[model samples]
Target: VAVTIPVSDDPTLPCLTFRFWVLATIFSILAAAVGAFNFLRYNQIALTTFAFILMSYPCGLLMAKILPSWKIGFYWPSDFLFARGTFIGGSLNPGPFNVKEQTLIIVAASTNLGAAYALDILSIQRLFFGPNQNPNNVGWAASLLLLWTTQCLGYSMAGLSRSWLVYPAAMWWPTNLVTANLLHIFHSDLQQEVVRDRLAVFKKITVLALVYELLPQFFAGYLSRISLVCLALGGASGKLGIAADYSPGRGTGVGIVTLDWAGVSQLGPLYTPLWAQMNVLISLMVSSWIFTPLLYVSDFWNAKSYPITSTGTFDNEFRPYDVSRVIDLQTHDLVVAKYDAYSPLMLNPAWAIVYAAGFAALSATLVHVFLFHGQELAEGFRSSRNPESEDVHVKMMRKYPEVPFTWYLATLVIFAALSIFLVEYWNTEFGMRWWGVLLAIAMAFIFLIPTGIILAISNATIGTNIIVELIYGFIDPGKAIANTVFKTYGFNSLHQAHALASDLKLGVYMKIPPKAMFISQFYGTIIGSIVNYAVMDMLIRNVKQIWYFTHHSPLAIDNHWNAQNPPVFYTASLIWGAIGPQRFFSGQYSVLYYGFLVGAIAPVLTWGLHRRFPGSGWNYVNFPIFFQYWGKAQSNGFANCLVSGFAASLTSQFWLKRHHRTWYDKYNYTVSAGLDSGSMFTAIIIYLV
Candidate 1:
């Protein structure tokens, strides 16, 4: 905290002024529109909060300079209903733009910067499922309700868990540290030599990255994934058999490297801690290089018949699983007789292992947090009640009125009821019972703290989607839409809770008023959801071939609108929902059930080892991260940038961090932010041109 985050706070700064709301609203709409639009493309890009930070600073400054300092006041008429004598006043410009305003703008804009998770449910239903498959048939009211409720339900969890997740010093969200530092650099006085130097470096790197990105991104596209093994084998068509399964573009990338900054930074090499990065790299290496090949060569689960790595599900005859044949279009439910007569669902080795890893990671997160951070959680709860033990940042934030717990409770209660209403009233479209929504909320509430703790400490998260899918698939068998709806509520609620907690921490660090933070984030969510639904609905209705594999559409490939996420989401529904985990988890894939046992036991063993060898770094083993990344290649193809990612981590987090502390502290995060901004802008410009 001392090295990266500023310890002091200036409480006199103005926040939530007229300028803030204007900028926040403008950026939030742009972010939502761009985010939702890009979400359907093959090369998905987001206008990140970091980019917002960089862009908003200048805009805020420009507003402060140009706008007149005019204060306006409004007084209620004497016969007004509620505020008979109340007066409200504000200014066009709130003096000079400060860090507090900048921080709040970033927070508000960021909430809607990415496509909401609920969009996945809506998209899959429209593109692949019955009734809604016709774009015009999609229900806007149901879609809006689903988007709003799922997006906002998590705020309640975040507010309720603030004591343990946000106020604790030990729960210092590492990612926020970088954000905090960048904010300070941008808004701080530039007269200081160190600040000036850092800004110069940031600018230089931004331009360099923007110019250098064109080669890998467009001109020399092969530089994005250069594989010596694939080159040496002369692109032979299975001539060398299993030995030639290392194509960076097509197969598991064993000896490959990516020159693209966007690809290299996918795993966050410059910001994530070294230990966590190593854990992910180690798991990826073992699973992709050694274990996956051995299973394929041995023809495990008839893996030789399918591609070395694929997200698609197949049948007994090694053909792409035709989901339409096994489903009754009239009811949107699986036809058991047709399914039984046809071949059972089969997954490639890589995809199969991804499910197992997801299972293990979920369980491991629960165990790891309980064993390692149990005492800290208890301490944090106690300290939250006793203000004397509050950290410096929290103490500084005490001047601002905190958001009331009742507000969060009301939010949770109201939206949760709305969610149930949607699923119940729109059962034909949603395909889930009212009780399923409650069950999903219960599961999300139960797992929020443990997963939040994991994210807060390690800067890595384990999603509850897999487990949610499994449980709901079993409970509501053969109903794919129902299973997905349950997964969205159960999984996305927890994910949003963590995101809110992280933003809350940023607020605390920046000394913004808690209530202001709440208002901005809540407003952003509503606006973003509306924009997301509008953009998605527009594309589905207007574009005839927006869905993948329609008319063998070249637009999907050339324009990078291939619809990658929906297809994967559709396949998952087929595997865990239509097929039912009961049938899928038995037979040839019965071994996957052991993932739970392995995940639960691995953390216990690590805890013991840490107790036995206190100084040997056993505590950093982090089984959850290892397991989560073990099968990462299954969904994210090849991961050709692991080598470059590791090299970047070594240089920034290890070498500069140890050898040149001053420079590292001043410019490390700045470099990461600059590179990201440059690459993002370049990608957008390239797409437009």
Candidate 2:
């Protein structure tokens, strides 16, 4: 019954730095050289799945270190950075292409859930769970179409609420601040000659570096494996072996084994501001390096049998738990006879702690927001009713006609019909019923405002997956796949709404025409949906390692896709979906469910301290955002990646900003753009070649 929760943890990258091409060139060489060797020696690319994504995280960090805030602005072809690269890639086709926000919005609107979560869902249902059939072979096209319909249903719901969310200035989706600021370098009057020149140079450098990674991507497949730890330890270090765990790809530990950029960079430091990176560093060091190691050594959860940091749970014998073997095909219930034989759930102490922190973060976010901005939020909703009360951005947006709510209503109606077919007519054996979809929609409605409130204030977000999954975990207890389906409807739509609202907010900030934004988004939606579908299909077909399980063992791991948070997702689903919170989180794990209450109360306590001791800096105790960093390791290791990132920011943000004000202003974001551009260009090139 284990299923992955398809929630997007929106990270707030402070747009300030593009600092490091100096190291990028070196990493590029390593990637190329090893990529070439691997191809020649093994006749395969050394790194196949999402190598580019790994490289961008560090590039941003490196850039932020060298570049002061004012020094530079924007990632090269900035639109191409981040998860939005798919649409940006389609739009930024060579020859004077304008990477307009309107165009980006269009692509974004088109790019739906089909691109990201569908493959994982199908992989879970078919490869890992039941039938062991190729997703492409059975009702695959219909499944995709149906999923897209559900996506539209979510988008339509978001559109209907635009008047309340988008028109309000206080509902400033913080993530869009980065995007808006970068886009302004071109669209706004602030386009400086220096900025344009830097962007041009960066663009050229990106293409060259990207092209060079071809060697590592194709020929020298070994270049991506510049793991000094693996080489030194021969990758055979036994139980609790730190050396074997240091490398990016090889290790179960959270330290860096090599300086290879291809192997190490997973945080997008280039676009992230220095301060945020510092916070991340502090959190990861305390948790991953210090806390995680201690817990693992202490046999936390009796976890010494497994890796110190992993997303997948294992049995007593340390085997990957196969829920498919335990799930009843007909009733979709847990086979009670087989259940007792199954291992009790065990998580890497790091992951378990992270999940627990996530729970805290969820509650902390609500309390913190209420304490800090409750007045402003109340005013924002009122502002929609009284146009004169609007914020500056919304007022400026008034000149342009608004995108009518009718468009959204129509979209919802159409998509809801499609979803009905998916729920009732589609192969029903799996049991994603009509009521589940209705429940999903209802959950989406309840969480949207609170989630939106959190997103507006802090670019940071905790996924609705926890809330939505928790709800369905109780309501639809034994229906594993149905639970996942319901979750996508409930959470993904809310996430999609946030994105839409973010875009609308960005438009208001830049004063883009609402009608134009709507049209562009609609067009982009079409383009993104089709292109994402094609790419997903291509990747699934070509990368069998990602879609298919290679073996049946406790450590039946898929290096490419499995590492990218799906296993973590599977664990989440197992806890809330299959096992249900009652038994799975009961007794020793009871705290997991009650985490919501703890999170809520913790903030109130902090707020009291702040109000009572105004001068004591109690206000700075931001537990929610602080706790958010705990769950980051499941995405990237903390040791070297985090420490180096922190160092880079410390000098630039704290030291330089304080003492060397002139230097800091001149180069703050410029340097980050350089390094990030170099790194990503290398990855894109590597991926292409």
Candidate 3:
């Protein structure tokens, strides 16, 4: 019943800078080291969870890193609003009820991040562990809870820069790089066959498009500004009996959406909560359960046609699903595994694009880094295998080891120095230049560090927009953190794009036709994004009050999973100026400390809760619900949240707990990726309308 319209008063619009980029690079490297180490120390489950975290907020960061167009892209509807929380564009931007806007951003980022991570974890587990294994077991749940709680605490302690934990830790594209290399080395002969088949399809398409269609059109329209070349000069143009040339350009004119927020002041207040709640539902529940599986399954079927199963049936590692078995490690003998194939349109094109882009960028990044800093990758990989040694990678460094303790101290010292130095060197329109810098530094160190730490533990690092919001606060102290973070992180819209990119890379590795994969994924992303957008808008508009509670009010709070943006702790940040349970760090919210308490005792809680309330119609033991209400109270609203959470959390657990443990015995990752895109798209359309 509490209509809390969450608004972001922070105004620090820190766009891309050399320093920021450099810092991000360092952060990413550190995160990657952490992720690889985790995989070694814990298991693939840990890596998958971490990757999901990374997908949440800085999801845009992934795209920003990979895609060319989204560099200066806008965030959410708030960007349309001006200083006064009024619209700037008459009909373009959604105007603002400041708090409401911020709340939606935070909620969407958090839910999306969690959903993506959940999907990734399940998929990975399904791939390695097997179909019969129950990943939702006490051990897996305990580990997951432990990690999630740890990350939450870490982020809380460091003020919540979630990216430090999720991004590099998840090893997004890096994992693909490793996977691709492995395939190339062991599955070279298999690759040759796939490459041949793929090339054949590509050639066929190219000829059809070029000869029968393009060549004739090009000859016809040789010189106009809007060239008619490549235009279809067929009799199918409208109802006309005569043959005509259609002048539709493949290039889309509108690059990014621009909104006008001024005139929508009245509309803003009315729609804020509505849209916010819708985003939560679409980004979280609908996308997770309904869409993800569909996309994944579709992709699996597409790739199933060209199998790569190993031939050694008697070998101990003989897995029914081990497609990589085609490569005879010793003999290098290759066996081409085949299944019923399908046409290009059957595949999810958008997912393919995401895969391709991610694959290319990751490959490019690795090449560039190796060429420029080969020693670094080698060192990092070695360090991962041996954490105790002061290897060559660490030895060749120009910078000495700044112990974590020392790093914090230095950060503070540097911040103080910069505050003074910048004040003398530069002038600001605001009188609080020195104060602002100090505050910014304070926010970064105080808020970001702990948030990052906990996020690392939880492995949910994608869009932890706490840093972006903090930066926004430092730049513009008057606005709320939510608006700033959303504008900064969500504006990038990177994850979806990155997902598409990664899929394309999968196609390349599988030897799916390059151009076909490109077309499918490109179209898929466009279709997915548009559908997602439409459904998202509908949900937001129709579900008015739901947004208010979900985004800001305590009613939005859930102890089951990590829903409710500007979460209970974030809300406390405004009041106590400290993170986690107490104003300082105490066991006041021990029940909420998922890692130490919830995660550790999850098995017990699962049993106890169910035993005490037999047939109560609530399953607290489930991963989906367990995660959702880990730190919050449990109730009915948690129903839908648990649906997606359970489906995503349990699916892999069901498969992995009883299956093999390596890529040599894995499920199709491409399938999962596709399902997530397509199903989520379809679900969004259904849910929103």
RMSD of each: 2.8, 12.3, 28.5
Estimate every model's Cα lDDT from 0 to 1: 0.82, 0.54, 0.28
- Against the true structure, candidate 1 reaches a TM-score of 0.94
Per-residue alpha-carbon lDDT of candidate 2 for residues 325-349, written as tens digits (9 for 90 to 100): 6656544467656766775665565
Clashing pairs in 1: none
lDDT at residue 300 of model 3 (Cα atoms): 45
Pick by lDDT: 2 or 3, better one: 2
Q: Which tens-of-lDDT digit does each residue in 1-689 have in candidate 1?
A: 76667778787788988889889888888888887887777666646777888889999999999999888777765556655566676888869999999998998888987789989888887777665333345478888999999999999999999988888776788878778878888877899777788788888988999889988887899888877676777764353232333442256676678889989888788888899889988898888877877777788877778888666777889888887788777655778898899978887877787888889998998899899988766775663455553557987888889999899999999999999898888877777898998999999988888888878877877778889999998888987778888999999999999999999999998988999899989988888899999998898777666764532455455556676678778767777787789878778788987888899999999999999999999999999999988868656653677778888989988999999988888788888878987887788678777
What stretches of model 1 exceed 4 Å from their correct place?
43-46, 76-84, 132-138, 229-250, 383-390, 547-561
Best TM-score goes to which candidate?
1
lDDT of 3 by residue, 252-292 (tens): 11111111111111111211122222223333333323332
Question: Could you give the candidate ranking by TM-score, starting with the highest?
Answer: 1, 2, 3
Per-residue lDDT, model 2, residue 619, is 62
Query: What TM-score fits each model?
Result: 0.94, 0.71, 0.26
